[model samples]
Target: MKPADVIALPFQWGSELRHRKLFHPRGVLMSGRLERTAPEGEGLPLVSGPILGRVSKALGAPGRLPDIGGLAWRMETPEGSGKWDVLLASVMHGPLSRAVLRPILGWTGSEFSTLMPLAHDDELWWLRARITSTIDGGGLALTDIARRASGEGLDVTVEQALKLNEFQPLARLHFDGVVSGEDISFDPVVNEPEHVRLTPQWLTDFRRAAYRRSREGRDAPNRPTPEEAAEAKDS
Candidate 1:
């Protein structure tokens, strides 16, 4: 068996025993829109539209226990041909620090980042997001953010950087509604835009193995691939 698959066996068993996600077991879903705001000169992908997202405590901690925050979202490709899934965890925003996931007590004051680099058009990029809208409370919890979203909506700025600390705004993500009890799973390893690949192939393989086992443990169906979607449409 592959090394990654072997390493992921425990997580698969844990999820199966618990009947929940190994990480970020509890979360709330939101419906949002993404508007591209990057300048033309930036090499960032120009994709934007409606999005479905989730915010959660990574360890499923309760009562403000310190835990990693998770922000994952799904959006369609600009060409409408496929879908892309991006998952980020609360972490430092620096080039080096961005690779490590940091535990945070609150969601608003923390920065969420894709710990792995993405290779697009032969260039490496990192995606990050910060909450720009203010919540009446301290926004210490996911429920606080949900309450704020259901009211005036929540605004978050999505930024991308190419191998440096300088990040340019790529899009403005607005969450305006709450989605209840939606059983959705996002696998960036499997659901990515055409020609955009996750870098450090070994790590990608590791994530693929881990995600597959997690899904299997939960008895969750995998999302349709681009080819499957097309075939279904044609049928």
Candidate 2:
């Protein structure tokens, strides 16, 4: 099987973050929710943002990937499952358009369906890094990190992500997930955590984008939607 689906992958040039609600019982509450609200109680720090590496234009030509320090992590289902996959991406609020939004909706539904993780502005720092190039070939080394495979459940650490995106040193990335039951710990430099105020429209669009992309697969951990299985009910 192909390791990646580029079109469905996150950070395609001009992609805007969006959050779509999962049809699951737990996610039903996501609807009517004003904001997921930045994670609090971390007591680490409230990071602010000029969102590292944002595209200034609302939409750019094809192949305009986000500057490093952004991500689009995803997992596909096993063969024959016929389910929606999962996708997790980080966004810093630049622009949202029909060109970006429509393809996202259609593609995510056809490919990945679950919301693997929700990337927030505070997490963008992990995606940035400095690299050696210059007379030797100076340039930016950006990565949109992702797990190699889609497993029962995997814990994605911010450390690996940032390292891939911005070239943050190999230091460790550690965090606790509500359902992931994972505790991450790794290396030396912890990317700074600052909170910059992202616009409401940015957030709204991000959530919507996320929401749409999360439904990439045809199957979920729970039951299938009526549209998914004509044979599912009354069987």
Best by lDDT: 1
Candidate 2: 10-residue stretch with minimal lDDT: 25-34
User: For model 1, how does the per-residue alpha-carbon lDDT over 1-235 read when each residue is reduced to its tens digit?
Assistant: 9899999887787777667799999887899998889875476564768999888888888755678989888999655888788999999656688888888866665799889988887888988898778755553567787887788998888889887667778988899999986759989999887777788999999999999998888885445666889999999
List where candidate 1 sits over 4 angstroms from the true fold. Answer: 220-235
lDDT (0 to 1) per candidate = 0.83, 0.22
TM-score of 2: 0.20
Clash count list over all predictions: 0, 52
lDDT of 2 by residue, 1-235 (tens): 1223333335321122222122211110000001112343332122221111111111221232322121121111122222211122223222221012111211111111111212344442222111111111112111101111111211222221321232222211111112222211110111212232222434434544443344443223444455668776557
lDDT of 1: 0.83
Q: Estimate each model's TM-score.
A: 0.88, 0.20
**Candidate 2: misplaced stretches above 4 Å?**
1-87, 90-165, 170-194, 197-235
lDDT of 2: 0.22
In model 1, how large is the Cα lDDT of residue 144? 83
- Rate residue 223 of model 2 by lDDT: 45
